[model samples]
Structure formats: C-alpha cells, structure tokens
Target: MPEIPNEQKKAKMPKSVPFIIGNEAAERFSFYAIRAIMPTFLVAQFFNPAHNPALQSIAEARANELSHLFVFFAYFMPLVGGIVADWFFGKYKVILYVSILYAIGNLVLSLSTHDLSLFSTGLIVIAIAAGGIKSCVSANVGDQFDKSNLELMSKVYGWFYFSINSGSVLSTLLIPIIYKKYGPELAFGIPGILMCLATLIFWLGRHRYVKVPPTGVKKENFMRISLYALKKAFLYAWKKVFFNRQDKTVWETVAEKYSPEAIDGVQAVYRILAVFAFTPIFWALWDQNLSEWVLQATKLDLHIFGYEFLPEQIQTFNPLFLISLIPVFTYGLFPLIEKTGIKVTPLRKIGAGLFLTILSFIIIAFLQEKIDQGGRPTVWWQILAYFILAGAEVLVSITCLEYAYTQSPKSMKSTMTALYLLGISLGNIFTSLVNNSIANNGFFARYTGASYFWLFISILSGFFLLYLLVAKRLPEKSYVE
Candidate 1:
C-alpha cells in the first residue's frame, strides 16, 4: 500500500463521529434523568411520608438497597449484549435494536409509577436494554478508525466521555425539578422521549459506520479458541494425576485450526480481565453518588446563598465538575505532568484515583459524623468532596474507556468492553450486598452513621496499596492500529 499523506492523516475525524456522540449525549440524558430521581422517587412513592423519622429512615435505607440492586442488573446485561454482537449480529444492529428496547423500558417506567411491581418490571427491562447496547456503542467508536487515523481514537473517546457527562449534568439538574413540579409521569415521560431521539440519531449513522461482521460460531472465534485451550489443559492435568504422564504444554495445546491471531486475541482477553479485577473497588465507592451521597445530602443544610437546593439535585455536581475537569485533565494536567519527566500510564492514573477515592470518603465520613451529632453542616462539604471525587472519576473512568479500546484485539473488542463493564456490575453487587446485610441486621449492621463511610474508606485504602503493586507489574499493550 502507498504511504498515506501526513495532511490527509491530520483530517482523521470520521463523519459518523457526530452521530455517535449525539446519540450518546441523548441516551445518557435519558438514563441519568431516571437514575437521578430513582432513590427519592422510590422513597416518596412506596414508603411512609408521615414525618415518622424511624419509618422514614428505614424506607430510605430500603430505597438505597433497591436502587443499587437495579444498577447491578443494569450493568450486568452488557455481557449478554456483547456476546450477541460479537457472535451473532454486528454492533450497529445490536445498538439499534437495544435502543428501541431502551425507549420501551422508559415508557414502562413512566406509566407504572403507582404500582411497585410494575415499576420493578420496568426497571428490569431498562436494565437489560441500557446495559445491552453499552459495550457495542463504545466499541463501535473505535471501529470507525484504522491505522491511518488510529491516533485520534483517544481524543474521540475523551469527547465521547464529555458527551456522556454533558447529558448527565443536564439531567441531574433538570430531572429533580421536573419530578417536583410535574410529578412522576411527565418527569419519566421526558426521558423516554429523549431515548427515542437517541435511537433515531444513531440509526441515521447506519450507512456511515464501518460495520465489522460477526464471527458467527466460527472455530477461529476468540472464545472457541480459549475454551479449547482450557479443555486441553484440563486433560493434561488429569493424565498427569492418574496415569503419571504429560502431554504438550498448555500454550502448545490450542487447536491447530485456529489462526495465530485468534489465539493471541484470547491471550489479550485474559490480560485485559486481570486489569479489570481491581476496578470494582473504585466503582463501589463511586456509584454511591447516586444513592448514599444523595441520601446524605438530605441530612445537610441544602440552602446555599439564599437558594434551597434539592437533595437529588446535589448529584448534579459530579457531572458538572466532570464537564470542566475532563478538559483540564486531557489538555492541561496530563501534559503538565508529562513535561515533568514522569510517565502517566492508565494504571497509574487509576491507582491515583483509588487514593483520591479514599480521601473523598474520609471527608464524607467526617460529614456523616456531624450529621449523626445533629449538626446539619453546609452542603458545601459534600460539594468539596465531590470536587475530589470528580477528579478521581476523570482519572479512572475516562482512562479505562480509552484503555479498554486500545488494549483489546479486533475480534474481541466488544467482548472486552463488556468485560470492563462487568466490573461496574460487580461493584454495584457489592454495594447491594452491604446494604442488604445492614437491612437484615447482619454483620454490617453494626456499622452505622459515620462508621458506614469509614468502612468503605478502610476497604479502599487497602485496595489502593494493592492496586499500586498490581500496576507496577501489569504490562501495557495497544492494538488500535
């Protein structure tokens, strides 16, 4: 092939980029709008509102459990969606179809407000729909560029994350006001409309995308090759234990029909998964901005400068801070650090984020202690904590988005993205289990008030030290070209 001109390479942004970013913005708005209101909405709709502090506290705790559990299911569905896209259909089809389901899920939530069972059913549908398309949409962005413009992938992913937080900031601020003013139906209905718009925007990009065809049960598929390798290893172990004999080494036992590329992709998947193992701890601390943080806001003095802030609206600070911080980190902080003769790797960023998370939770723990002592401290304390948390999110989440794409093999891109998302699901499960245990007066029930935040702080501190050791040893790779 002839060498591509430098000037041509400079104009590397794909036409389909706008469509993907627009769809992501609208879709994120729809998702965050619903999520922003879910906890308070659940407590208001189902539990006692008669000013009984004991019942109200119990109700709020249950709301936290239910909310986190819903998030657990939402994040878990990406695995199924990734498998379907990589093996049966392509990314575009999966995104298009699942987006329609997403719209329906929102509609169901809008109409089912009065009935808990119906609302729970709506949540389940939304979880499957939203999580299903997530991995495909992200992987599809990387698919748009090849070796000619692969350097632009990181910049595009940054913009993609910016679009997500843009939607989040708008929804987090607006949805609470809408819910308070109009009621659940209209509040929920607006998000459903936006989801439909997101679907339409994505569908308009169909012909522009460079759609990768599915592997479709091929023997050379990454999963097939990995499974064969595992089977060979098992038989080799069995023979050694009983017959006292050995066959070929494990790596040498992969099926011959599979190409070297397929085997390499399987190996890449394992490495990516190892890095993903430490992410759940980060997410477990981060996602509380949706539930526990908002709940904590209610105990604070929400009035700031003659304006009363809604508890749910306080969650807006995260995305708002993200909108500003992403650019600062991408354009300023990272470059400044690079100029200081220090290398900034993804694992390093993530490890630093773990430390920041511990700090944020310590602040939260202090604030919770004040609340328990009947001192309604200003909301600014939490906002200060949000500032720190937002910085950590910039380091961890955006870096992971770029890392997961670049490290993945072409054939398993969506699957690798799904595996990364599985970490979020696992984190939410951890949060849910903690909440459940507390609700049942189990072992965790002993940790109350400020101690709750301290518990996470301690857990994350240990993980932060361990993640440093892991990052030191973990190798980095890139396959964007």
Candidate 2:
C-alpha cells in the first residue's frame, strides 16, 4: 500500500523546537541588554558625561547617529550571512561559528569602556556576529517542519517571536538599571555571558535538528542567476547605448543563459523584494523606539511609584507589550477577525500595521510639540505611543517573519529572509543619514522639533499608499509543502 501523504500525517512538534526557542531567548536578551544601554552609554562615555547640562543636544544627536549606524550594520550583515549559509557553510555550522564571534564582540565592548577605538571595533564585530546568523536562526526554525506538520509552523513562529520579546522585556528593564547603579562594564559583561550560554544551548540540540545541507555553488543557484542577469543587463545596456543596437531585452538575454527554474527563482526573489521595498519606512519609524523615542523619554518626567525610571528603560514597554500582544493577536484577535467571514491574509495584517504606525507617530508628534514649546509631558504619552507601536509591530514584524519563510522557495529561503532583514538595515541607515544631516546642518535641517516627527509621518503615509498598490498585485507561492 502507498504510504500516507505527509499532509495527512498527524501534526507533531519537533523536539528541537525548544532548543531554538531557548537559544533565541538568551540571544535576544544579550542583544537587547546592550542595545538598551547604548544611547546613554555613548553619551556618557564618548561625547560628554551623560548628566552634564552642557552641549546636551550635541551629545544626544551624536548618540542617535552612532546608535542608528550600529543598528544599520547589524541588520545589513544578514545578507552576507544568508549567502554564506545557503551556499557553503549550512545554517548550523555558520550559526555555531559566528556565535563565538558574537560572544567575543560583547567581551570586547565590556572591556573597552574607556577607549573609543576599542569600543568602535567591538561594535563592528558584534554587528557582524549578530547579523551573520540572524537569517539562519529563523530560517532554521522553519526547516524543522515538513509538509507532515506544516500546519504547526505558524504556531511555532509565534512562540519564536514570543521568546524574542520575552528576552527583550527582561533585558530592557534590567540592563539600564544595571548601567545606572553599577557601570557600563558589568552591564555589557552580562550580555556576553548570556551569549555564551545561548551558544551552549544551541549546541545541545545539534543531534535533534533537521539540518539542511548547503546547496554548494551550483550554476543554477539564485546568486549565480542574479549575477548572470546583472552582467547580461550591463552588456545589453552598453550595446544599446553605444553600438546603437537593440536586439533582445534583458530578460531575454538572461533566459538564454539560465535554466527556467533558475530564472523563475530569480523572478520570485524580485517580486518578494518589491514587496519589501516599501518596508524601510516602517523600520525607519520602528527602530526609533530605541534611539529617538528614548531621547524623547529623557525630556519627560519619568518618576512613578516612587522610583525614577531611566529613559532607556522606558523602551522596555515595546517588548513588554509584545509579550502580551502576541498571544492576544494569535489566539484572540486573528481568530475573531476570521470569524466575520473575512480571510486574514498577511498583506491585510501588514496594512493594518502600517496604518497603526501612522497613528502612533501622530501621537508622538503631538507630544513632541508640547515639549518643543517648553511644556513637560507625562511619561504616559510616550507610553501610549509605545503601546500602539507595539501593536503595529505584532502585526508587521511577526507576520513578516512567518510570511517570508512560508513564501520563499526552498533554495532561496535564507536569501529571502536576508532581503526582508535588509529593509531594517536600509531603514536604520536612512535614519542615520537623516540625523547626520541634521547634525551637520544639511538640507531639511530646518525641520526640527515636532516637525521632525511630522516628516516621518508624511513619508510613512506615502509609502503605505504605495504598499497597497503593490501588495494587491503581488503573487503568493509557498515552498514549504
């Protein structure tokens, strides 16, 4: 008799799931711990004392630029990581190797509190270390399920995200306080220790994992097709412009050289990339939670329940709210929406997130106006912004994580995930450039104070419209089955 089809097989959780989730939790704790303290630490250690009333704006601006640049590099390096994992090392080996670098980077940071060059070198290494494995980890989680239990994949991703925020909530709340009472050394050291633990946790699951071997450097690989397509386009352009010859289109030229499957794979990558193109603005607004939002909190009155909260600590709300919001949306909100005879698709969720992000920034702009006019606002206003932003994040970030994996072709999963992450990298780099411009008195520097928030709101609104246009025509293909 023919064996049962995998889809008809019972859904079962993989034994390796716990290890991935646990490793993610510890790893996120390490990342967020240092991130929570970075803005204030930069000002304290590099520019001027954190508390000095002189050149405060300069110090804050410098902090924002450096912090955003760091985040940019962290997100950007995933492209290299994805390429390395998908083409040569495989996910398990790449993650294990870079994780060692990750631990060392944190140790370097912990020891270099007094030396700017040492700190900068350490930050670059950490960026490479963290980003190098970022795509592999999540993609690896998806690798654990086959068509036999593909139905369980979404739930696993939810828990995966839940663990990430759980770690974030703890670190964001605790680390800044450590930085305050103790010093940067211990605050940074703890994350290094946690990273080593994260590595150990991952290693323990080695035998249980469903390891996907690297595809090696095949001619039909996505990277090869992409590179060939580029070369063809360049030659085509050169011929068209100089030789006054127009024969075949770029696609025609590419098709001449690559297989149909390879060409289709590259086209799929382009389509997914098109969807991702609109997302950088969302990230530009989202990552501000760590940089600009923290600065805004510093200007507010942070005392509550007889304890003064650090401005950096206030960002704890994003992850804190996320820990609660994930389940509510997964079990409560999504199911409730579907019951109304409406299908809750990924694009719909992302649209809702984009709209909510607009609302959050509007609220932030209003609060900033009050502050710009010399009125001290309550911490609660920013808290509200954080809550709404958290809701947007639940809808966008979590959905993208699941959607990217489910939609990617098997050969291109890590590459697609890396592209999704590149949006964050681009967003942060955009943010860094904007802040750098403002610091150096470049164009649009006059849009300061509440106007700065308005500028982002305007950009996000325009992009949301563009997203709607593209999303409607975007094709969906699932490779998981």
TM-score of 2: 0.86
Show how many residue pairs clash in every candidate, following the order shown.
Answer: 0, 0
- Considering summed lDDT, which 10 consecutive residues are worst modelled in model 2? 50-59
Error at 96, model 1, angstroms:
3.0
lDDT on C-alpha atoms for all candidate structures: 0.86, 0.87
Per-residue lDDT for 288 in model 1? 91
Best by TM-score: 1
Q: Residue-wise lDDT of candidate 2 within 1-481, one digit each (tens)?
A: 9999866778899999999999999999999998898887887788777577655666666778888888998999989998889779999999999999999998999999999889988888998889998978988998999877888999999899889878988999999888888999999999999999999999999999999999877778776777888888899889988999998887888888777777777877887776677788899999988988888887898986778889998998887787778889999999999999989998899999999999999998999999988888888889999999999999998888778777776666666777888899999989888878876778856667788889999999999998888888988877677
Q: Write the per-residue lDDT of candidate 1 for residues 77-109, one digit (tens) a residue.
A: 989888888779989899999999999988899
Model 2 segments more than 4 A misplaced = 1-19, 50-54, 142-159, 203-212, 230-253, 304-307, 330-345, 402-407, 468-481
Per-residue lDDT value at 463 in model 2: 90
Q: What is the clash tally of candidate 2?
A: 0
